[model samples]
Target: MTDMRAAFYDSYGDVDVLQVGELPDPRVGPGEALVEVRAAAVNPVDWKVMAGGLDPLMEVRFPAIPGWDVAGVVRAVGPDIPEVEVGDHVLAYGRKDWVQAGTFAELVSVPVRAIAHKPAELSWEEATALPLAGQTAARTLRDRLAVTDGDVVLVHNASGGVGRMGVQLARILGARTVIGTASERHHDRLRELGATPVVYGEGLADRVREIAPGGVDVVADFVGGVYDVSQAVLTEGGRYASIAEHDVPGIEDRIVWVRPDGAQLQWLADLVADDRLEVDVVRVFEELEDAGAALRANREGHGGKVVLRVSED
Candidate 1:
């Protein structure tokens, strides 16, 4: 009987519901790769799923292993899958339509579409941090809003994992200027990333207007509830997109759902190799059972990515 240690929750509740124990080894279905997880990042969605917030939206079977991001080595490939072979280093946004089990385990089986060669320049934790947040940022700016050169872009919560990625992607896309909203503490870091930093809160619209006096060309809202500021600051014919707000009251805005796309992950990895992008793995919990603590850190809004080092490798 093959078994591996994993963090799982049999019932929906708080972080207390999470438990670490042995589970039968997973099978790799055709077109799937069994990855030996080296590191996995804890995002807000992981705890939310464990707490049943997404129960009505996505199916969750009992004893669900909770996580969506992983950086690891391919241990085996199912028959007919030629995209990746054993021993390949890879990373994935391992999202499934339904939750059965996930990446918070030593070994996770993911479809080929979700697998990308790990960025040559990134460490395991950094690679794990890239998928979910990086994809959200890239998909919104490149596909939904289509930001281009000479365009002024405004990003809400620019210091966060997702917002910071948006700031860098905007620069890579040739935006004339990137304006970011953050607390006073993160303002300097935002400036270092080539963004004009504005303290987030009252007078946000006015502050953004002052930076891009002619009005901004695009607005990417990572923090929700910024509809008013988005409307007030966008130029006529400007585009608006949000990862947190699904529906806006007055305007047509796109709500981004980060999806798993190996090709898109490769694009992000390339940027990392070129040193044009960065993933800050701020905290790492070494034990698998410490996943609960990792979730708590995410809940507390710890700055940058929080990762679980699944193995020393």
Candidate 2:
């Protein structure tokens, strides 16, 4: 067995715990494909998990790799797998039952159910940026909220990575009108993506009401702390889903947790390929040794996703 270079941590902590070094290549299971990682994206959950934020909810093993998004080439497939062949370009939200061998590595063995063909229209960085954010948006809007034709959708914190995807996907899901809440600085970008932008603040509900007098048909909250306003603007019987704000009263059933679904990922990839979706990648860290910095960059916040280039294209 050969050792592969990876970014991992021996114990839970902050970015300082991450180290770039050699680890044994992950074993390919019966339904998995060995991916030669080209790029990986850093999500908020990655660093949170590193700090043991999810310790109560999910089990973690030491020497854990912290990442969930990957875009790569299939180097080999495990036995009984026929869905993807070697040399196929793929992207996935490769979150497993437990966190150990993750996407922040030179190689990762991805379950076939979580792998989707990467669109040629998207670069490795862009492809890597899509999986988690895109899937989160889809899970909230398409799956949970059931966004449909003629629906007027409202996306909270619509300038962030997942919120941006939610805004565009709302329109793509046949929304007659899509209203996005963000700061004034991001309003123009929201408009370009087919959303009516409203500045989020004291009058957020009023601003959204001005756009959709009857109220929004669906509300997707990617950022927490707007539960009051979200409820105020949601029409009676309207669907509301949140990836954040799980602590709010009566929102237990409304909280959405994104899972790895290859079919859903492929739908998002095809949308990007057909020019119906856009992936915003704000920064790219070129070295695996820079993983700590990448995690910090994501935590500091940006308008788009931060990605790590694991291998040259």
Candidate 3:
């Protein structure tokens, strides 16, 4: 039997429940590809699943592997998949189901529709950070909110992985001004990304008003408490999208979930190849064994993406 290393949890609990061990290699199915995972990104979902926070919402099978974003080379292609072949570099958002084997393994099998060709300009680690956050950002701005040129866009938590992607994508979508809320320290970085940085705190609304005096055309709130503030700043018919749960007056019913789309992923990959998009990975752990620690750090709000470097060769 082929052996592969993976970080798995047998029982839903804390980070301590995560175990790094050898497991039988995953087998690819028709229309799937076996990826020699070079890197896997840790999202909030990983920790939430491991700690049982999502148990009430979704049933997780035991011995679940936790991760969503991955970048790797195709090691073997299963029958009936023609989009990729062995040795093709790729980036993918693994299925949302936590019960299945995940990217935090030396190898992972993913459906063909979840992947995109890795941009030639990015390294494996950089590509690893793109799928989850990038796709979410794209879907939120382009599809959900339908932002347009001259629109004013505001993104909460502007320096984080998803927030940064939102900032950049908003600019690309031709928003007249992209205003971001972050700590005082990240203000400069946000500005460099073509966003007007405002410190998010007690008076977030006032600060945003000062920056975009007319009002916001779109608000993408990645931070939870900014929902009401986002709603307040919108021009009539302005759109508001949030990745986190928030209770915003007048717009509580507008919340939507982001679904994975491979065509969107391909468009994002093209942006990366053309240097219009940037992947920000804050740090990379060398192996799946370190996933527990990485998850812990991620929970503590480390900036950018934390990726696990998984390899068998």
User: 1 or 3: which has the higher lDDT?
Assistant: 1
Where does candidate 1 stray beyond 4 Å? 247-253
| Predicted model with the maximum TM-score | 2
Clashing pairs in 3: none
lDDT of 3 by residue, 134-226 (tens): 888888888888888999999988888889999999999999999998888887777878899988888888988998888999988787776
Candidate 1 per-residue lDDT, tens place, 1-313, comes to: 4999999989999999999999988898897999999999999899999999998889998889999999999999999998998999999999877897699999999989998998678889889999999999999999899999999999998989898899999999999999999988888878888899999889888888888889999999998999888989999999998888756664443777888999999999889988999887779998898999999998888568899988876
* Candidate lDDT values, in order: 0.90, 0.93, 0.84
Model 3 scores worst on lDDT over the 10 consecutive residues at: 245-254
- The TM-score values for the models, in the order shown, are 0.97, 0.98, 0.95
Question: Could you report the Cα RMSD, in angstroms, for every candidate shown?
Answer: 1.3, 1.0, 1.8
How many clashes (backbone atoms < 3 Å, residues ≥3 apart in a chain or on different chains) does model 3 have?
A: 0
| Ordered list by TM-score, greatest first | 2, 1, 3
* Predicted candidate 2 versus true structure: per-residue lDDT over 1-313, tens digit per residue: 9999999999998789899999999999899999999999999999999999999999998899989999999998999998999999999999999999999999999999999998788899989999999999999999999999999999998999999999999988899999998888888888999999998888888888899999998999999998888889989999988888967787799999999999999999999999989998999999888899999999988688999999986
What's the distance in Å from true for residue 275, model 2? 0.7
The CA-based lDDT of model 3 is what?
A: 0.84
